[model samples]
Target: MKTAYTAALSMLAGIAVGAVAIEGLHAQSTPKAYVVSEIEVIDQGAQNAYLPKVTELIKSSGGTFLARGGNIFAVEGEAPKRVTIAVYDSFAKAQAARTSPEWKALAPERNKAIKVRSFITEGLPN
Candidate 1:
């Protein structure tokens, strides 16, 4: 959980930094700055343990968990798991958090405990 929160805080910080960068770029007539992260989490039968830790991590980082799988509206896969999508302010910060020591500490058990898919994207002005 601490890891997620760290990432979230990083996201918030990154957004703030991006805003500053964007404002400066605008002064020079540059493009806007933005970052997007799509994260998916899967666990067959250990949500009880996985969620609590993740919850703690998210809370610490000031991350808002956008969606968590609720009452089975539908099932398309054979895997029994849920998905959690969280949005951070920017890709840079999110990546930083993911690679940070705090998050790395959780790595030892993270892989065995759950499956995580993360996508980081930066938005360019059209």
Candidate 2:
């Protein structure tokens, strides 16, 4: 009876360890989300007014910019006037940032400043 009890306890411990290992691996492999924007400035004065406010909103929404209107050389197709790339920890978070109230509030000002084409994509696992 004692031997059987010991074996059962050992099996339970092994199962618990396996479960933890799987969870850890899943967490480590979770993919990130990237937001890419192609912008064309229409009104310089309006764009200047819109920049700071949008920047602040992005930062407040827990996004980190990978690129913000730097030099671009297109290999095949035409390059956009400007490009912006930001990354979030997860796809859900990225979507939330775009749909947030703060972002919505800035839309009119942003539209007045620039024409923007944007998309969100899931990145490879970290």
Q: What tens digits encode model 2's per-residue C-alpha lDDT throughout 57-117?
A: 8888879999999899999999999999999878988999999999999989999999999
User: What TM-score quantifies how close candidate 2 is to the native fold?
Assistant: 0.78
Model 2: lDDT of residue 21: 100
Question: Taking the tens digit of each residue's C-alpha lDDT, what string does model 1 give over 3-68?
Answer: 999999999999999999998766454222222222244454554566677667755654556666
Candidate 1 local Cα displacement, residue 59, angstroms: 3.3
Error of 1 at 102 (Å): 1.2
State residue 95's C-alpha deviation in candidate 2, in Å.
0.3
The candidate scoring highest on lDDT is: 2
lDDT of 2: 0.94
Best by TM-score: 2
> What is the RMSD, in Å, between candidate 1 and the native fold over all Cα?
14.9
Cα lDDT, all candidates: 0.58, 0.94
